[model samples]
Target: MDYLLSIIIFFPALASIFIFMMDNNVAKPYGITISLIEFILVMVLWMGFDYSNPNMQFENTFALITTYGINYHIGIDGISLFLLILNAFIIFLGTIYLNQPNDKNHLVVCLLLLESILMGVFSSLNMVLFYIFWEISLIPILYMIGAWGTGEKIYAALKFFLYTFTSSVIMFIGILYFAYLFFITTGKWSFDVLDWYTLTLPFDIQIWLFLAFFVSIAVKIPIFPFHTWLPHAYGDAPTLGSVILSAVLLKMGTYALIRFSLPFFPDASFALVVPIAILALFMVIYGGMLAFAQTDMKQVIAYSSISHMGVAVIGTFALNLEGLGGSIFTMFGHGIISGALFMLVGMIYHRKKTRQISEFGGLAQIMPKYATMFGIVMMANVGLPLTIGFIGEFFSLLGFFKSHPILTLLAGTSIILSAIYMLILYKKVFLGSIQNIKNLTLKDLCPREMTVMISFVVVIIFFGIYPKPILIPIQNSTQQLLQIMNDRAIKENTKIHLQNSLNKQKTALDTLHIQKLLKEVQYA
Candidate 1:
């Protein structure tokens, strides 16, 4: 298990080199085998993980640049463990489900490269190493979209690149400045996040640095106005690309919010909570309305992602165990739900050569099994109980309600909006009588497709019913993060203010009988 983290990070890239030399016919199976091994390796890491320990485990550091105090430092805690597994799992499924006809081997290579880069992004503790991994990730995704994508593929790819890269450059400047601050204080240089966490700046400096990091994270999270790039990117990318993009890539933003923003700028985070919550609530309602208006099936899912991620962001800024825990849970839940939905859309596209919602109806009459699976996933998308989606959304809203009740109420409307749009989509696509003969000839899920759908269903329902295993570790880490924020808060007033909010929330929950109900659910 020595160097297990590094091995998990680099295995895919090294495997890609060998697979790249093979012909398309054999490359896919070889790639799948490699990805499967990677997945297993991640699971092994999980098996050996110390769940009760909130500190970073599997840590490995090697000095990379002594003069700057940068190193090849990496580790994983509860926050990152599942995301790493998610990256490995999604890419493995994506490789199995891949169906590109041209340059298939190259596409497979791109996926493998993405897997490696993303693994690094999740595990690296050094700011420089994390940034390097963060920037390199854009390349494979760009190639995937431009090379194998649909209409306006090149345009979508370029827009995605410019938006993310330009904003990330700003974040890099922040990182360098942060390191400089550390050096000035300690008389040495360091880009280690753990080191930065212990270095406190004045409120004014914190505000500037927070803004510097927020702009980049917001764009990546694709919050509200910055979200325009997403629809274009998702719409044009191939199925596998869309799957990985929605599943694992977008999370990098929200993850950074927890990993870097909050701990690094506690005073600024406390000061900015209201405005950020406003933006998050606005994103929730606006994205939902836009999704309701989309005629294209894929576009609906794309817009919905904006709304769902908004929920995660709100939970993040809630700045408590419940909120942070719910946010991480939401991230994992949305990843699985959204990725499955995109795959379903891709399946329909492959058969009908179209994604127009009005193009086909009475799909259930022709493809009962696909309809059944789609129905289950659609229910989960709307946060139906006993489905994975409901757990995260419920806890997220509950968490934020404690902090900003009115805003949480507005945010809760997204649940209704999501139900409306998703149900409408299901009714439009699957509930009608066979009107188009073209649809009558469509087949149900094949063995390969069935495997993917079943896997999604099992995970969705299994985790929904029994989420404590995941929730416990997430809460453990979030609690540690909250301690960091508390200990680092520059102003005594900021600490007291946030503590009072949490106390009032606890009292309100107890008075309303909500606490009792939650305990029942937890034990159930």
Candidate 2:
């Protein structure tokens, strides 16, 4: 297990160098092989991982800067274990299932580089190491969108970069400030995150620190108002670009919320729960409404992401075991569902050369194989029972409903809205009369496409029915986190924030002093 996580993180980067040297003809297969090996190694990691143990595993540490306490520390706990596997599997699938033509090996190398950075982001324990990976991951995707994307690719790429990178500078400052705080408290210079978890700042500091981190995470998740960059990026990127962006990249946000935000500022999180929940609810409704109104299929999926990810936000802010666990589960669920849907859309666009829902009429009649598989994925997208999406959303809403019934009810409305919008989109694209004469002549799924598409279909349904494999591991990790937050909250009297917030009560002393002045005057 020693250095295994390092190999997983760096193998793609090393292979990308080889891929860069290879002739164009040989690069794709070699890239696919590297990714598959990476995926298999992660599967091995999963098999060996003890779901019963909630602590970080596969610990690997090497000092890079002894004076500043920057160590190359990396590990995985139950939460990151499954994400590691998902990232590897999706990158493998993204490489194999791509339907584009290429003349140079740049795209291949970039994708591999992107995968390595993502692996580091998920598994890195040290904030400096994590920040390095996080910042570098932006470059590969930036190249992908601008070079290989569609209309206004430059605009989309820049928007995506500027939105995320600029916000992250503030986050980087927060990390350094926290490190400085830790060094002040205990005369040791360390950038370890586990050490910061023990520091309890005043309520006011938590609010400002929480906002600093929130800007970065929100832009990534593209939550509500911060989500303007998403549709343009998703709509402009190529198929595999869209797949990785939607499936994996977006998850980094919700994952950060769980990993850093809550524990770092438990009291502030509790105090702001209602306002944040309202914002999440707004994301759910507003994102879904936009999805319903889209004419382009890619835009539909892009907007739906905003709506879907809001559930994860709701679950997280619920501040309970179920809420935290379910929020993490939703991250996995959204990744799978969004990845498959983007693949299917890519397949459609490959054959039709168009992404408009209006351009895809009678797909069910013309390409039954494609239609059937597509239908199954869309059902999962709509959160139908016996599908992966349903269980995650169910648990998320179920968990949060206990804390704020009204807000949970509002957030849960996305199901009906999503079902209506998604199903309507499906019915329009797949079930209508043959709107275009060329549809009748279109070929169905080829051997390569079926192998890829059907495998994803199986994953969605199998995990949907038997979610325990993933759920239990996620729960194990989340429960440990929940225990920490709970123990801290008890000693800090955290629940008072929630009660005061709800009752509209103020704990601060009156500043106006009108009544005090009158009493003083009367006494005089």
Candidate 3:
């Protein structure tokens, strides 16, 4: 168990090298075995995790650059624990789905490497190490999309790389400047996020730094105007690529907003809430409309991702326990729901050799099992009650409503929009009489595909019914984060903002009956 975090972080990378050298015949089996082991390791970490403790656990630090004070520091709190598990779980399923004979060993290698890099991203406490992992993650994904993707794959890959990388460079500049400020304030050098949190920055400086970080995070979240690359990337990338991109990669931006932006620049976050909320509300309605307009199945899911992520963004900036917790939970919910949807679409494409919604009809007649699975996932996507998706959206809207009621009303439109588009998609794809000759003979879910779908359904429903286990830890962490933001606010206005938000958050929690649940969990 010693260095458990390090081992979990590096094992996939080491395994990728070995799998790369594997013969094409055994490569998939070896890759699956390796990924499964990694998943198990992550589950072990989760099992042993101290959910009641909000601070970082299993920390390991080493001075990688002594003079610059950039150490190889890593740890995880409740906020990061499930994200790590999610990364591992999704990669395991992705590897299993990539069982096509033509799936080269290198593809598996790229996936494993991406897993390792993302693991580091969620766990690293040092900003320098986090950035290193963050930047390196682009390589495998770029190669995956460019080499194995569909139409305009190379163009999509390049656009994705350019947009994300360019914005990241701006963030790096912010990181360096922020570090310099840290040195100036303390007469020492450090890129540790914990250390940086101790510094009380001027409101003016915080605004500049917040923008520097926000650009990169927004582009990754693909918020509004910056989201142009996503449809192409999702539409053209291979199914596995789409799954990973939607499920894990997109969350990176929202997660960073929670991990860095709110805490690092509380004043800026409080000051900019209205504008950010406006953009988020716009994305919610806009992405939903675009999703409704899509002909291609992949593109529909891609646009829906943008819409759902907007909710997460709103929750994050709500700057309270209900909003932050809901945002984090929504990230997980969206990951599972969206990934399942892409997988179902990929299965259809595999049989029909097309993703155009018009090409197929009455799929339920030919592929009842597949249709059923898709229906469940689609319902979750729509945020139907008692599904995993509902919990996050309900809390996110509730939390944000406390901060901005009118904006939350606009944001709530996403729920109706999502239901309309998703049900339309289901009806078009599965309800009508079979029209195409090819569709009449299409096969249903096979055993392998059934296994994956079943797993997704089980998790979705299980968590939906009883989310307290996850919610408790998330609330614990968000409480600590809010405390930090509250404690670090230098401006009187910022202090008042934090206090008002906290009061509203407390009221929301009480109304939702979550405070009772939290106290019970704590007593137990």
**Largest lDDT belongs to which candidate?**
3
lDDT per residue as tens, model 2, 404-436 = 898898888899889988999989998878898
Total clashes in model 3, counting residue pairs 3 or more apart in sequence or in different chains: 0
Q: How many clashes does each candidate structure show, in the order listed?
A: 0, 0, 0
**On residues 57-135, what C-alpha lDDT tens digit does candidate 1 reach at each position?**
9999999889998899999999999899889889888888887776789998999999999999999999999999999
> Cα RMSD (Å) per model?
2.5, 10.6, 2.8
Of 1 and 3, the candidate ranking higher by lDDT: 3
Clashing pairs in 1: none
> What lDDT does model 1 reach?
0.89
Candidate 2's displacement at residue 4, Å, is: 1.4
User: 2 or 3: which has the higher lDDT?
Assistant: 3
- As for lDDT, the candidate ahead, 1 or 2, is 1
What is the descending TM-score order? 3, 1, 2
Q: Model 1 misses residue 433 by how many Å?
A: 1.1
